[model samples]
Target: MSWHSDDGSGTTADRTVEVWPDDDRLAEELGDALRDAELAERVAAAGRAALAAHRREAAERDDLALELFLLTLVHDSELAGGPVGVRDRSGSTSRTLVFEGDGVGVEVELQDGQVEGQLVPAQAGRVTVRRPDGDVAVVDTDEVGWFHLDARPHGPVRLVCESTRGTCVTEWLSW
Candidate 1:
């Protein structure tokens, strides 16, 4: 199910709740499985991944924003369908990617081996930039929702944001 929320910013945001299939057997099996601590941990991780995938799909379709956790894909980029970032004498390139998830949005710019950006609606939060290998950097956004990270390594990357506005994860993008 889905509901609306206001974070004292006077803006209403939509949130989605967990939903389970209408199958007693499956529920019973999951209940039994949870009894095993190790198994339960694995199951939880798998479930989170699955939920992320679902959110990514919904975000790609321009679905409503989720208050608890929002996973979104890149919505637009002037540099879309372009070649690798070109570094000039300054040894940095500039490309802005915009991602939208309901009431929240993140705009990231990569340049000079650093990732800098701002969050729409401007709230304090944390930004984690991760690659398949692991998280490359985690930084806190100022009260105005601006964050910066240096020493970025190029590869496939995804961004996760957490704040009073809630959590949001962006789809994997080449960096």
Candidate 2:
């Protein structure tokens, strides 16, 4: 269904479209609907671009967010933010992912060997990580823009984020 929400500026003209059931059939219908709605194609394209940009920004920001949160936990909680080295039912070890943000940090610990890290909203996406062995792993962020990479067993590994905006990388540390 097509919906709209105001920007809370006391003006209904300044509205944001909210589409539901983002499925293939819905998408096709939306594309057809856009043909009838005035400037709907531009609106949809702009909205998609904006959402893609936001996803890229989140991925770029995640390394810092993870680092800062991990630092806080390591100092305040006295917990090891490293790979626990034990495999779960999926045959992958759990890892605590700490990323730093501006004045605020986020920590996500998952028992899945790698954090599903970033959600890029672009079909054309890349996640480059410098492996502990000095090899690089470049992966597509998927259609929905989600990407995952296994953190190294030990030694210094760096996660590099690259997208239409630019590129950013994390610091080297033995995990």
Candidate 3:
């Protein structure tokens, strides 16, 4: 009369995560009335708010140290023959990019076709490089407002510096 056969070989069950009780904190907190879409929307909104707040706080700093840190990381690529001279085949060639503006001084070395440098500014947020190819690369300064640029050709190039207050661009440099 039972659902199982009297032979004692019915169906055995074991504790498995997929088939067992799972964490229901989110469900419990949101309640059964809230749909999945609503929960997702709420999470997205919260994330946006947090991102906005962080950006605002960064903008309110005395200087762009945080932005400079990011810039350093991106521009710290290794370039050969330094960033100033033509690419050489021997691999002993290297150059340096010197950025001087608004009482800030920064020196970066170019080797292995990469840029590795730093920022020595009282305050800096962003740094941008416009290569002769018309491609643009922008990097944020770190906590110390330091930055570097990747190794590129000696053609017409532009360097732009930016912060919460404003932006400044270098005229042009010959390779």
Candidate 4:
């Protein structure tokens, strides 16, 4: 038994294959192969089911994200359009970004190779630093809603705040 098939580069390739010989073991081997194929199909179905469930969960999270406060960029001190923080002692061209909102306000200070922030209407919470690559860090706020990220923002970054009051996701900003 022999055959010819494409080698997957738009080129045809010669192939050689052998079929089972006619013998008492042939039937048993065929039955085993069939059973193995069935098992493979079952496993594939399970994988599909798991993928669907994961997608559904992601959709649910997106829906809930709608209720979250999307922190908008209201002020950027470097542009001289807003106020900058006075606590920047290391002064590595420190910049302040204020995201003002009706319910919760946020101020982010970038200085001395650190990212510091404070939430308005101070409350305890968790802030997740998210970057285009992936999650950078998740830092918990103090009782006064002050938090700092250990990871430095290299590129565009966003913050997801989950506090006692509510959840909010910030707009992506280039750091």
**Candidate 4's residue-wise lDDT over 1-175, tens digit each?**
8778987899987778767677767888867876797787997899999999999999999989676877787878877745544554554467788886558878888877688999887888888889888898999999989998767777888988887767887788887
Give the per-residue lDDT of model 1 (tens digit) for 14-53: 9999666678877887888889899989989999999999
Question: What is the TM-score of each predicted model, taking all chains together?
Answer: 0.53, 0.37, 0.39, 0.64
> Which pairs in model 4 have colliding backbones?
none
lDDT of 2 by residue, 1-175 (tens): 3445577886564345656555987888877887876678689889999999999999978865554321222221125554446566777655555544333332333443455555323334566667667655677676544676664435566656555544545555445
Point out the worst 10-residue segment of candidate 3 by lDDT.
68-77
**Please, what is the whole-model Cα lDDT of each candidate in the order they appear?**
0.81, 0.55, 0.59, 0.81
Clashes of each: 0, 11, 27, 0
C-alpha lDDT of residue 117 in model 2: 56
Q: If candidate 1 were superposed on the true structure by all CA atoms, what would the RMSD be?
A: 22.3
What overall lDDT, based on C-alpha atoms, would model 4 receive against the true structure?
0.81
Candidate 3: segments with Cα more than 4 A from true spot:
1-91, 122-124, 132-135, 148-151
- Candidates 2 and 4 compared: the better one by lDDT is 4
Best-matching candidate per TM-score: 4
- Ranking by TM-score, best first? 4, 1, 3, 2
Clashing pairs in 1: none
